[model samples]
Target chain A: MIDESRRVSMDIHYEISQHYFKEATYLQNWKLREWLSEMVDEEILYWMPIEENRLVKDRRPEPTPDDAAVYNDRYKHLKQRVEQIYTGQVWVEDPRSKIRYYVSNIEAFHTDVENEFAIRCNVLVLRHRRDTQIYQHSFLKEDLLRKTKAGFKVVRRKLTIDARSVQDKNLFFFM
Target chain B: MSDKDVAFISGAVRMYRERRGWYRSVCNVFMVGEKSRMEMRVMINVKELVDLENATQAKKIFWDQDIYDQEQERIFGRSWLFLTHDSLIPKNGDFVMSRMGEDKVIVSRQKDGSVEAFINSCSHRGNQVCHADSGNAKAFTCNYHGWVFGQNGDLVDVPLDTLCYHDNLKKAELGLRKVRVESYKGLIFGNMDPDAISLEEYLGDMCWFLDTILVGAGGGMELMGPPLRSVLDCNWKVPAENFVGDGYHVGWTHAAALQILGGPLAGLAGNRADMPYDDLGKQFTTRHGHGFGAINDAVTSIHPENEEYADFMAETRGVVAENLGTPREELYMSHWNCTIFPNCSFLYGTNTFKIWHPIGPGKIEVWTYTLVHKDLDIDVKRSIQRQAIRTFGTAGTLESDDGENMSTCTDSNRGFVTRKGRMNSTMGINREGRHPDFPGIVGASFIGETSYRGFYRFWAEIMDAPDWEAIKVQNDNWDEIWRGSEFWSDK
Candidate 1:
């Protein structure tokens, strides 16, 4: 009962979601450099912006990426971050936070660029560290994925958390 | 008289009053109020709390609830607290929510280019009137009961003006409490006490140092906000003292970070034994407790990855020297860890401005913003902002490296045995003196506690004095505390 075009599109969506799952696993396992090399494009942008509580009377979009952010990085900077974490010296993550990412609500759309699709999802990241309460962070994530020869590679990821202010002691764990 | 002699006389006076039963009579007549009674019982014993002679602070100061209450009343209630920068609310009616100590404040830019600030609590009921962080607004309406306050914090509208009260309510008198506000080079600060000194005077000799960064590079600085905010479970003073002068921790605490990043400070990584400790940098503290530790030629050192920022600073260094003099010219490119008394701190090179707003004795809400030169090219400003956040923002590597220590430093004081202990800050005690070119006491090395001693000295001075008038009496004698040694005479 399934047409070939519809089946192929559904398959691509499933493949993208699967790719995301693998990427999350890599991050959770503290295999950051491996994830960067195997799953991300050479020209990737990873950004996590600070959210502000705005009044309804002064409605405005969230701050731009160019504005201050928690993590705003290009491929080179992201690699540097991986190196910093792996140095066994960044005291913040000497014993890294145990983090699990619950990625859901996946939606995909084709971009004008070749073999590229814009994927949107909602994620809930639960992080536990150093005998403290488990920090719950709910965020909306948007990823630009390219259909490379080896499957899908993330070209951009923008994460916007729900709260105006972060409650976590540190964002040592990637969401 | 010696400080100890004055203390002895005061103790004798107290004993005499107690022996004659006059103390109780005086309490009955003058301190009948519950608040005054509580204050009297928990009055800060300056001599016991801070031993300037030993450069050791009683750990109780970090965990005692009573001392924290007095600080809220005497220190934060009277200090010039940083509110917001002119760039944050440049236009008329633009407002930002900030805190002065534990009290929430709303700072607004008026139509006339002047700024105004007010307590965010509603006059009718104790509800927060403004919840938004920063925005342009004609008025703020209380969500609880719909009492509207204008941009200037005047009561503009009441939900039931005529029908409910029949003009019985004095709307004119039911306005938000106005906070005294002033600006220095585009940085706005608010004070609850009207009798407090002007912002410039409060800053004092620190201005000569601040101008090197704030007024450098063609124009002054601007803060990039909606700041990154996070709560730190630590006593406010822990971070304040750290930022005031904690360079000793940098090469040790952030050794791994600096080494992996391979910046100018990378040489200090892992406490490298061969590193020249004394020649690294110097520290200075002013009369009002404002202080900084300067690491020579390390400005833009944290941003090794940002070429544009490095180039921008390299270009601006000459102009800054021309504008601020050679002494400051040298400081123009030096990295600085500084604190402006009570709770504002910023790293001049790191460019992370922080306000440690105390929630209680054991907790502080850290609000951080990136500081940038206003006149720099937009790209350059953005680059600096990015690099600053990457290294020192709310989730920054260096910031995270410090959070655990700050929290543990305060939380451990809850132990009765721990609270009774003393914390030492005697590094470079007799090794600091007046700088020939710079104002205030200058230490021989950056990694020293000269500023810590000065900070607590002023803190005790303020807490012990009954009023500003009483404090002024000791103005001429302030520097005498460190007069025994003239260590920096040759410099």
Candidate 2:
């Protein structure tokens, strides 16, 4: 009994929400290790502004690790970071012990392909560092969420804090 | 001799002898009294510092615990440290949290249109009262014990205070500890010491330099918050000193980044020999250690995509010339990488402002804000903010490039014996001297270390001054050290 437009909108919404829920659940359940091991085309293309305040030209070099050592170091560090979360490293979690990441205001757009849809959402993350203590509240993080077949992933997350200078204990939680 | 004269002479002699003695007696009574007096007598030398013109290694300004403690007392405690821009707290009851060294401070705009800052700790048991980074609030109630304080830092009410203290508790004594707050052209600064130098005097010649950007554009700038905060494993001084006048690093450290951007400065990557160096704008070092390295005619390069911003600066230059004269007018069009000594730094062209909050000897929390003209359209502000994040934010290409270097520099200096060796800052040694046109000492080129020398000169002065009184004596001698010919006279 649904109209064509309503039916199409509902279908798109369901598809986008399913992807988002899958990614959120994966991240919440600490499936980064499994995700990393998967053979899916996991290349991430990040485009940032150049010093000239414009989009980089074709001749402009791609964004890469600064040096070989830095690349190796960050790679190892990323692996270690994943492991620490899985192991419940108290230092990393202590500051963000209680956090609820709410991803909402989702909007879907078709990419170059019909099967693949680019999903965008507004995320608000709140953290209580310690139980019953309210001196330091984590700054709100605004991020851009994307959807893929594997799940919902952060394509570009921009953290817009409200203070001119952040007064948080530390930035240890993912937004 | 009279009894009073004898007592005075005896006390003076005892003090002098105790100071000279290799090992003074450690009696409990004498120790307590002597310790108290000794703490009071520890005078920091405000002048007479070793030259930093040849600094090669990273300086020990970051790792010295004694220096850190002294800075907390002398610099952070006494100076009018910058807090936030006025735009951040436009409405009454609007508040923002800031840091003075390690202590947290809450800056609020009151109903009377005056801004007030106070320690964030609760007056009752010293628990932090406000937890949010920034928000509009009529009152801040401590979460621990619900001790409520008004927007103006007055202890308005307490839960069951009549029942708890039975009217014995003094309300006046329990108010938040207030800090002296002032604003210069919309930039707010806080001071802990009542007798500290006025913000104008503390700024000194830096005001002339600041006016170039602050007062130049038809409308002054406002900070777009919240800031991008990230921890860097480096001494706070490294970044401050770098921004003060180290444009030399740009062509080298950011060569890869520049090549990626492919702007007008792309050819300068890898420091190509054909690149014009002398034609670049001159560098400057002021009496108060504020300095900048400016690139001539390249202001727009910092934000080329935003023609509105470039047009804004172009239009405002004439008004600034009328207000602040040609020196600052020229400065308005030039791309500047500058520092406001000790902690605050910003790029006028790039529109990125930062405060390096020291965590310890080898760590700092960098808070970055995008600066924009207050009168700019909302879309222009958004564009500027986007550009700022793409360049200076924690995940920005340039920021990441600099962060690794800063951390590595700090970590490498961890070798115990390596720290004893002094770093050299002597770039363009004997090349910088007094200039007629420029208000302060002028270096020949933007890459020169004239400002680094000036910064360390002040650093050493503060580190050495026996007390605040001693620092006052060197006010006259600040310009005497310069002995170079006036080069700016022709310009």
Candidate 3:
């Protein structure tokens, strides 16, 4: 008997980790179309909200999808973004930024829904571009995944980047 | 008399004098440069560097540290920098960390709803006093010596004053150096130089244009923050100039994104020759280096899905027409890429506000915010914000598309010979001139580099002028160069 809100079994945790790794692999290899089709749910809400630096004592509510966010994207929005990559006129990626994604500390918890699992993980991505410049991004990613007939699908993914100010030119690559 | 305590009074005066003298030196040092006034005047002949005749800028401006440093002294020092908006800090004690050139600043809203700013440095020892990006606080306490400053930046408390300094610390004189702040509509701006003109006057004729969006509808606009911040390897001016008036790059630089983007302007993918070279829209350049290039009737064009914004804009267009007039009504419907001299830029239609804070000559910290109408439906505002970031935020499709070009544009100048070369912006130079309806020097088409030259023209003036007084002298004849073309009279 799986209690809702309880941590999932080790087998379920391993299963979610494998699923996350595949999503990371699809992102790393520039297989965005496949990533979306195979790993993402049609009603997915991919979000990355603008987080302010506030004092520990300050209790203002955190930003929601209603506020300014880097990626408050729906399935259609994500599809459109992914479509631009395959357009071939994308000159910036022609030389191809060498990117490696590391997903770790993944934990799975049972959600209210029978097949759905609430997941949390840490993602560290390193990107090397042109000749010398390199960029690093660390994120605390909160995700909701569901076990479907076709395997696993990401229902939601909210990424909180660690750095207050991004050191890179842009966060173009998937995390 | 004998009761005067002569030694104590004299010692205090001497100490006060000593403190005053040290502060004067700190002011000169901290303000970037006042001691080396002549060096600023003769260091670089900006007229030579920014050639009005050629519409070319020296590549050195993008790569040289000396040129960049001079800009911090003249351009950033003299300029009215964008601070925060009223909507973001609705409550008192709300604050945000900002920058003026390289100097760190703390912008705070007081209990009286008045906004104030500071240099963010401690009065003693120069250690950073306020560390967080923003928060509610009664006072800021220095980590070093526990020196406490009030919400208005007045020094109020210090650690063990009697035990430490015999109770003689001058708290009144040692408050965090205040900056001159003024708000235009709901948008707040801070100036370092007290002698500089008011923010409204500094905006010049751009204020006339800004009012279309800022006040055309009933409630005007408010910015959503904290902003999307990222560092880009490019001169602050590069993006500033681009947004000021580089409509030419939209089709080419964002070709990939546009090919797939099903929008009104998607026909512009790859800068097609058939798109009417001179009929696209108009570019306007006002005094004080502020400028914009307007693309015709494409408000909310980027947000293809949210026709709610388009519908809301259509509804507001009538109100704007009634309140402001026909020109502004038409402006209300149009999309614009604009910059307020130096480094603040925004795309009106896209509603993406940006502050390009310079890190060095070839690098900048790009702070991005979403500007929304105060009266728009909450859903519409949310949709607009999403679309704004999707195209212009840190990982924006279009924004992602252009970062490489901006980086490479500055990177090429790293070479010795390359740094000495000239880069041309001479597109549609003859097509622009004065206009009857508009107050500024208006160009024939949006794609022209007419505004680019105008931007550089004022840039050179500000960089070379010794002070605001010197700049004020040339104000009457500032647009004399563009007036030579005489396009409006012929039209």
Per-prediction TM-score to the true structure, in the order listed: 0.92, 0.73, 0.92
Give stretches of model 3 more than 4 Å off.
Answer: A1-5, B1-42
Candidate 3 lDDT over residue span A9-111, tens digit each? 9898888888888888888888889998988899999988877777788888988888888888889888888888888888888878889899898878897
Where is model 2 more than 4 Å wrong at Cα?
A1-175, B1-59, B484-491
Worst 10 residues of 2 chain A by lDDT: A65-74
Report model 3's chain A TM-score.
0.95
- Please state the CAPRI-style docking class of candidate 1: medium
Docking class of 2: incorrect
Which of the predicted structures, 1 or 2, would earn the higher TM-score when compared with the native?
A: 1
- If candidate 1 were superposed on the true structure by all CA atoms, what would the RMSD be? 4.2
RMSD of 3: 8.7
Error of 3 at B332 (Å): 1.1
Could you tally the backbone clashes for each prediction? 0, 21, 0
lDDT of every predicted structure (CA atoms): 0.84, 0.66, 0.86
